[model samples]
Target chain A: MLSMQKVSFRYGKNTDYVLSGVDADFVPGKFYTVFGPSGSGKTTCLSLLGGLDTPTAGEVLLDGISLRQIGGEELRRKHVSYIFQNYMLFPYMSAVQNVVTAIEISGKGGREAKQEAEKVLLSLGIEEKDMYRKVRKLSGGQQQRVAIARSVATGSRYILADEPTGNLDKKNAQMIIDIFLRLVREQEKCLVVVTHSQQVRDASDIRYELTDGQLSLWGEAAEYAEF
Target chain B: MRNFSTIAKRAFRTISGKWKGYALLLLVVAAITLTLYIFFFWLDASARLATQARTSTEACILLQSNDRQQIGSLPQAMREHPAVKGSDTTTLLTASPVNFVNAVSRQDSPFDLPGESDQVLVSAHTDIAMSDAFRTGNASLVEGAFPTGSDPQVVIEDVLAKRNGLQIGDSISMSLSLPGYTEPHQLNLRVCGIYHLQQPIEATYYTSDGTPVYGASPYSSVFVPFDTLAVRFPDALSQDSVCFYLTDFTAISSVLEQFRQLNPDPARYTLSDFTDYRYEQLLQASQAVGRLILAAVWIFIGMELLILFFAILSILRSYYKDAGILIALGERRRCVAAQFLFQILVVGVVAVSVTLVGAFLLTPLLATLASGQIVHTAAETLPGNAVEIGAIENMARLLEEHGGNFAMLYASIAVLSVLVLLGLSSFFLFSHTPTRRLFDKE
Candidate 1:
């Protein structure tokens, strides 16, 4: 679970604000959806939640511990798995290789890491036939699936998906939504899906929309929302 | 702790990935290496030549003058001085017009007086005083046997033998003239044996002037017993002039002072030392080659650094998005720098390994190209013969025998430079490029 209070950020002190006065909370064992217009700071929110940036003002807490207080990259590799909007799969790698990247990044040993990558892809219902194919040859939906598998493979408690279904077709999007809902409910991992897609909003258990720099819960009080 | 294989594997991966880099690096390295080889090989050979020149039994002192009456007193004085390891006195008689039958040009020039060899060599003990005439492997009798038991047998230098249509047991004519005489007086002597010398001095020979002459020559050395030479023309040797030889080769100036006080003729006589010998000249020439090698090495290494830095920068730019993603994923600046650092090491190891293997493999072929023998010659000191293509092979062999010292020094320097390269690359990475390098971090 992650929580943020009055989180405001500007790229530089004198530059116009990129995010400002944002207060939000992300709960574990829940599928949380983040929706916003373009430049609405949803990406910034997700990055903050995953410990990618320092807010100009406000605090972000993960499992009651502030993400800002931890040592940077190692902590992220240890606790958070991120899926970028454009699906940042390791390009020279295969589908399984993409999944194994996170494991290697986390400094887990190799033989066991590959097995772990296989387990994640298998659980996502990606076929073994496509596992060895390089990521560039795979379809966008397949690439997104590989990214999701990598995020899951590391067994991190937090999953920050930046527009996970943004580039997918309706069928792939619905399938991905279903996978998130199942992982959040059963595995009890924090799944924060940042997207503006109405279908993702419609399927999520809770939704928060970022307007300007602030987030407001628009749901039926999926409230335990503010820590 | 990983030995050869692990390092080699890492090197192989980098080479396979960046074939052009490997090729460019090797091209420059090979050219530089060959240049260094020529240089270092010369140095090694010349260095060995120095030691051999120092260690060999050579003429330590030679005194030449035209006056036989005054120099005859040299034996008594020289024998009294300490540090007289050994001494050899020879009578070098000069004249003109040998008058050989079927001769190329009945040249009336030096070496017309064929002096007695034993009288010329009688100053020192035969065991120690005998000049190293030539390598014995090249000595064999084509007609009769070598001159034995002082039977008045004569041997001529190979050039003289080839010049005149003379055979063993054949007779030859010679002449000797004094200052008072306008024309040379002639005498005939029988030839007995022929020999060649390893020394590259001008091919010359000697003779019996009106007075016995003591010296060396090209096509000019003739041997006769001291008794035979004395019976024919007896005279004491001249020693009015003086050339100095100190106990140590380096003390020429101080020893020159001593020789001046002892013999007192500075104009005609001069101090001779190691530097004046054939050895030092070869060494200087080799060092000149080494300087060229050192310059080439510096240029090559500088080029390598420039190329490597630019190449790495381009690679980093190509992966700008990757850097952004890593930064967004919370990778610290240090980790990003380390990855690139590892990448360059991978390349360095591959390139260096290829060079080492290629150098070792091609070394023998290079050696073959440089096949000159280690023939020590007096002409190594003479002008027009300091270095030449004809003797490069011999020079190379001598260089090879002494190259281990140079190799150790060069390799150590190379390794140190590589380490410094690592530090410089890392410094460049850390100080010049930060992980927040690209503006598009999302």
Candidate 2:
């Protein structure tokens, strides 16, 4: 389980807090989504969960150990994976290479890594020919699939995505949502996705809304909630 | 846990993906390398030539005296002086032209002429072979040998021998007026050798009456064994100059002081100043130019390194997104930096290789150009006969032998500069910029 305990964040010393005393728990075999308007710190919440950024206050723990004690790099490399909203695939690498690199960075490489990358990319509906082309040459939906494939190929326990389908069309977004559901059900992985899309929020098993520097369950009072 | 091969493979991909930028960098680095190598070559060749010129040119001190005993004993004294390691002394004497047989004029006469209208003026020396012309290869034996033994053997100039129809076995007769003799002394000398003068040198001598004779051409002179001449005419006036072959020409003042100590009395002996000051000055000027070239090389390297630093910084900035992606994917920061380092190293190796090959191909041409410049400078600054083409050739040969080493040294420096600057720039870019900021568009 990856959990954020009383987390608070501010950009700098004099800035107002973006997240104040917020708490959340992400467990395996569950699909969760955090939805909010602009400036609600939804991406900041996901970044903290994935060890991409350290919380200014409070602790992020993986399986009851503090993220700091586990070391951010080691936690990210061994237990967590991320899918950025912009689909930050290495621009110079092909789709398959991007997936393969993530797997290699996760400490599984060689011929098996290449085979696994191609399998994951193909399962995401990316064609064999497009997998070898640079990601910049791929379409928006294809790039998102490649990004998802990169996260899934690492086989980490926690998959933290910031707007996984923000740029995708309806059909691609639904496919991505279905992939997330299957990852949670069949693979028993923890999926925490931050998005503004109602479709993503409705499809998830658990949902929360971030507003005014507080996190609350959907349809609940606008106050920080501990879960 | 990333291995070197994995990092290297990723680095190779990055390099090949952005080959255009790396290609431009290679070209810039190669141009800088070539320029630096040329400056180094110039400095090395100039220094070597200056040293050759300093060591090869003869530095001498002329010694003159009216006392025969003092002047005659001076050679033995100078030979024993610790300062004169390779020194040689030659006593200059002039033969009277009265009743001197003209070998060239005798060719037209069937009978012997006792008093020929054309007289052969002769200058005798203790060691005629030690003159500058002979030492510097300006004069060579044409048919006969130098007079070495204590015989009345004479070596005449080729021009005189040819004009007089003389051969090696022929004899020449001269009449000398000695101080102790009441009548003129007649002597017959065998023509044992003949020498050709490639360049005529003006010689000065003192007559038996101590009269200074200037503008005497070697073409009209003959070489007789000094012991034979001195023993035959003990009162013969001679002009003697001691040539000191110093181990270090720069310490000439100390050697001159030693020479002065040996012959202190100004009334009996006088020493001429060392005559090769211009050559020494030229060497010093060459050394100054060498130093200037070295300074210029350092400044050029500094400018090139600055350009390289900025270029690397720009590359890292452009690749910020890639770095963010790699870091997000769990690649260590040092591993990412190593990727970029390997990228720059690929280009550095290529540039260094190209520079080595270019330096090899251009060495002869550059050496020739350098030699021509040195020779031209030497000709302008030195006396006409003092400029040695052999010294210039030696400089070129030395440049060839050591030019490759110089190029290798500079190539190493170029590669090392790229590595050091890349490491610093990587640290600056990676250590200061947060991973989140790397994803920012700016």
Candidate 3:
């Protein structure tokens, strides 16, 4: 479980906070989404949860271990994986090679890593022809699928995605939503996604709204009381 | 842990993708290396030539033999010594060449002596002295012949003979003036030959009267056989100096050392050889030229390094995004550094190999240009008959023997500079570009 305990953040020496007094908990077999408009610190929250940044105040804990103590690079490499909206694949590499490289970085064996990379790419609706083509030559939907494959290939328990389907069309976004739901429900993985799309927010198991550096649970007392 | 295979694969692909940049870098490095090689060859050749020129010249050794032990046997000793080519002996006196010429003409106070100096009178007694005289075109027997021995006969240079108007068979009287002697001792001799010389053998010294005088050339002096002079002034004819010419010029120092061991007292016996001194002078001149070449070589190398530094920096700057991506993917900083280093090492090794071939072809052209200068400078100080070409060729052979060091240094510099570039590139990655900014762009 990754949790944010009374977490607050500010950029540099500014007086106003980008995120303040925020509390959140993420667990396996559960899908979490933070939805808000621009300037709502939605991506900032994902950045902290992904271990790409540290909160200026309060602590972010991973399985009762501090994210600050584990170090961002180590935590990201071993426990959490991030996916960006733009799909930051290496332009020079093919879709399969991109997946393979990510898995290798996550410490998989060479032969097994390549096998897993191909398996994930094929499952994500990437054809054999497109799987071997350079990422730059791949279409937007195919590139986003490759990025999803890369995130899943790492096998990290927590996936912190900042608007994973922001650049995808309806059908591709729906497919990505299915993949995320299956990962959370079947694979028993915790996924924290930040998005403004209602379909994605409704597909998630729990929802929170962030506005002006403040976070609030959105469901009614009985409907969300189990949390 | 880094997956080295991935880094290597990526490095190769990156190089292939940017082949033009790597090619340009290789050419620049090869050109710089070629320049260094040319200078090394030229400087080495010039230095060897200068050393040979100075050491191969004629050497003169001065020695004092108060007792006739060493002096009497000097001619034979010099002739038998393996290093000696030729030798001659001379004696100085306070007697008069003018008085002798005046006596031969049967006239007193008729004209001023033409070849006379107000210095101590000096004459040499050697049969082979004519070898130097005739070979130099300085003198030849114009009338009659050279004396067979110290047979009471004299050969006078043409200038002295002309002023006195003396015939070849005319008898002359020479007198020696000693400070404590009751009367002047004299010897009567007949003139055997009269030779003309453009430049003559001259010696300078002070007379018993303490009058300083500069000596005149041998063309203005008298010469005779040693036995007759010894008979006439037995007490005055001690051999004070002997000069030896060596067959091998390089053996001069060792022979001089042997002479020192023979005569150890510095005050009573003074010795000097010009070979070592001349060698030092030539070495200093050559070293000055070599220093200039070294300076130019280093300046070019420094310029090449600056170009390399900026070129690598530019490449790294363009690859910042890639490096940041790698960092975000959980690649260690050292892994990123190694990836960059591998690429640089590949380029550097290829460039150095190309330079080796280029330098091999270019060295001969540079050496030929320098050999002409080597010969010309040698001719300036060496005798006219000396073989300047042979000395230069010998220097070339010597360079061939010692050429490996420069080639090694060339390779070493290429490798070391590449390592430095890699280190700087790694530092640039760690300190100049940040991974957080890479993800923020999305």
Candidate 4:
């Protein structure tokens, strides 16, 4: 389990807090989403969860141990993986190579790593032919699938995604949500997604809303009521 | 946790994918290398020439003594001097009778033949074959060999041999007039060798009617073994001169002072300073030029390194997005830095290899070009001496020896420059910036 305890964050000393007193719990075998307005710190919350940034005032812990004690790099490498909105695959590498690179970075490398990467990509609906093409040459849907496959191939327990289906079409977005549901139901992996899509929120098991540096359960929030 | 081969493969891929940028860097590094190599070659050649010109026999001093005992002892004394590298002694023989049988005669002959017949009068004002004149390249042996040891042998001039149809192993008779002897001592000597003067001596003789007749043909006297001459004419009047080669030309004044301490009387022991001031000035000028070239090479290296730093910085900056992606994929920051460093090193090694091969292939041509320029300048400004020209000719060999050292130096500097650039860029780009900010599209 990964949880945030009264976490607060600001860009710098002079800047106002982007996330204040934020609290959340993520467990395996569940898919969750955080929705908010443009400046509601949804991405900042995901960054903290993924160990990309440190909390200002509180603790982000994995299995009751503080992230600082676990070390950010080790936590990210062994416990969590992130998927960005832009499908931030290495532009020069093919889809399979990107997943293999992620696997290599996670310290699970060898000739077997390539077979594992191909298996993961094929399971994610990427064809064998498209897997060898440079990511830039792949479609938006295919590139997002490659990014998700990279997260899955690393075998991290928690997959933190920021707007995973933001650039895909409606049909492609639905397909990605289905893939996330299958990952949670079949692989028993935790999925924490920061998104504003109604399709993603409907597919998730639980939802949270971030507003004015605060996070609250979706149905109980005043913003959700207004929406 | 990436291994070296994995990181190197990624670096190689990145370099090949972005070859245009790396190619530009390679060209810049190659240009700097070529410029630096040319300057190094010039400095090396100039320094060697300067040293050669400085220590040559042109910087020697001559010590002449008319005192018979002092003349005999001054050579051994000068040879034992600490400052002297070597010494050569010459004894000028005068009015020795030389008779040639059945010789050819010309109208402009300086020698008065008997009754205009084929008998030639040869006045052998000879010196030793190993005298200062021959040692200094004033004359060279054309046929046979120099008289070695005391063999009662002589090497006549080429013109004298040609005029008299003389061949080697022919007998020549000379009489030395010893002091307090009514009769001259006759000695029969064999012609063992012949030599030609580098610069022929002009002859002016008076006819019987007091008209001066100039000879169109050049003439020079004979050479004999000094030991034989000294043994045969023990009491003959001889002017003795000693040439002293100093170990250090800069200490010529001190060496001259040492010589004066040995022979204090100026009238009996006259010192002729034959040190070539022009050659010394040229040496100084060459040294100054060498220093200037070295300075320019260093400045060029400094400026090129600055350019390299910025070039690598720009390259790293362009790769910031890729680095962020790698880091976000859980790659260690140090691994990313190593990958980038490997990329730069790959390009650097290729550039250095290309430059070295190019330089190796072109060294002989460059050396020839440099030698030609130095030889032309030396011939114009310096005397036509064999030692100076030989030194100029040695530039090719020196360049070959120094070229290897220069290549090694260039390789070291190039690799060090690349490493420094990588270090500075990594510090600026990776150490100070956050990974999120690096890949942040906005």
Best by TM-score: 4
DockQ of every predicted complex: 0.23, 0.35, 0.18, 0.41
Ranking by DockQ: 4, 2, 1, 3
**Candidate 4 colliding pairs:** none
Local accuracy of candidate 1 as per-residue lDDT tens digits, B68-169: 442445444554334332343321111100111111112452233244122111111111112233221333334444445444445566655665666788
TM-score of each: 0.65, 0.75, 0.62, 0.78
Candidate 4, position A222, lDDT: 38
Off by over 4 Å in 2: A220-227, B65-240, B246-262, B274-310, B374-388, B438-442
Ten-residue stretch with the least lDDT total in model 4 chain B: B94-103
Instruction: Please state the interface RMSD for every predicted structure, separated by commas.
Output: 5.0, 3.1, 2.9, 2.6
lDDT for position B384 in model 1 = 65
Cα-based lDDT at residue B110, candidate 2? 20
> Compared with the real two-chain complex, what DockQ does model 2 have?
0.35
Docking class of 1: incorrect
Q: B405-427 in candidate 4: lDDT tens per residue? A: 67547654856585657655674
**lDDT tens readout by residue for model 2, B9-111:** 7877777777777777787677677777887677666666566656654565566665667665766776655545454433222111111111222333322
lDDT of 2 by residue, A144-218 (tens): 889989999988989988888877899988988998898899999999988878899888878888888888777
Query: What value does the lDDT take at residue B359 in candidate 2?
Result: 88
Worst 10-residue stretch by lDDT in candidate 3 chain B? Answer: B93-102
